[model samples]
Target: MAHQLDKSVPIPLYYQLKELILNDIKDGTLQVGDAIPVEKELSAIYGISRTTVRQAVAELVQEGWLYRVKSKGTFVKAPKIEQSFIQALGSFNDQIRDLGMTPRTEVLELEVIDVPGFVSDKLNIPLGSKVIYLHRRRFADNEPIVMVKTYLPYNKCKFVIERDFVKESLYPVLGESLETQIRKIRRYIEAVESEKYDFDYLNMEKGKAVQRFISIGFNYRDEPIEYSIARYRGDKNSFEIIITAT
Candidate 1:
């Protein structure tokens, strides 16, 4: 659909044009993989310069709404690759399994290590205290989706650090081996750009966005027992929160 910009308005031409294109995608008038009008055509129809069209399209591409193919035109991106992330804070393995997808784990590092200061503070242990650290790569349908680093006080989960995590998930292992239950957890989530490990494991572009989740978990006694940092592929995951007003 052609959108006319009122030159009389104060809005920047490129930005105004961008909203028009964005609306089309949001409304599904531009379906996934659908090619948008070429720059020349858009410029002529919108009464804007080709330069303005290029700028608008560049922003859309960077924002994950559109993608370009060499020697071809730009097309709407596929629907965001996302999964169910609810406020209940279920394990990723459980969530993925319930979705009928294969959830695989690659045990990158599973052993006790001297705790970093940040981890020590979160788990309420002394700095340099030994902690069971588990570095794992989590996948769905064989596609890497998250990198997880979990720190547990050595006294709390030392028995778990030596198990074969490649065949089992950490939460389940904790329950079976230590009879530990997760009573509560606090999570801080934020958007971030891909780090080096994300690039290597998730096959994401270095500048692409990721969702970082920092969690501190407590046991039945309400004592903090675990601290973990998990980074999920932003393009592949989203979260939902259900609220009830008191």
Candidate 2:
């Protein structure tokens, strides 16, 4: 195959080929879900070995730029949504919309339940205290991205049980209904194996990992207002933390 790929340059052939496909996708030459050229065709186009083409394609697949279907060729994939926590404290709806994607939320469960010991401690409430437990699955562009379980002191937050989470976000509701503003949020995150909720709500397969976030929101009075457990599909989401120098 005659090619214009610079063989005299020090850059590897496979990486160059990978960049070529990435540029094509960036410039709208390849739309999402469009199948990329086969290894043989790509090899011919680049005058590279089949192995080089395979390497480039495999890297793209691993990096979430492409996906492979058994008995079918590789296709372009939607990019992961970046969830920036530190840079902005926007609601999921606002954040997803800023990224040019539609945001949707489904309330899976909403009821008052006895607070478990762990949740009680987190909320600094009594162990036998009742809480408004709200479970939700959030989506971006109709794709399931996260499942969250939120616990709020029932005595104060019972109003939330009646609000329509599908058409609303909890944070805004809290600000409107509560007497004080949510002044701070403490969050802990870890990578953990997916559970039943992940498999059921997130469409994750067995053995897949999820990013678990435990967040405690505090009011202006320094009292805990909400404790939430959110699990995000690692492949569909990425967290970005911005660091600024003082």
Off by over 4 Å in 1: 1-66, 75-78, 177-179
Best by TM-score: 2
Q: Which candidate number would show the highest lDDT if scored against the true structure? A: 2
Candidate 2 C-alpha lDDT tens digits along 1-246: 222577899999998888888988888888999998899988888778999999989999999999999989899998888889634657989999989999999998999999988999998899888999999999999999998899999887878888999999888989985553567888998999988978888999989889999888888788999999899998888889978899
Q: Rate the local accuracy (lDDT) of all candidates.
A: 0.84, 0.88
lDDT of 2 at 66: 99
What does the lDDT read for residue 223 in candidate 1?
A: 81
Give one digit per residue, the lDDT tens place, for model 1 in 140-165. 88988899999988987878866898
Give each model a TM-score.
0.72, 0.91
Clash count (model 1, backbone only): 1
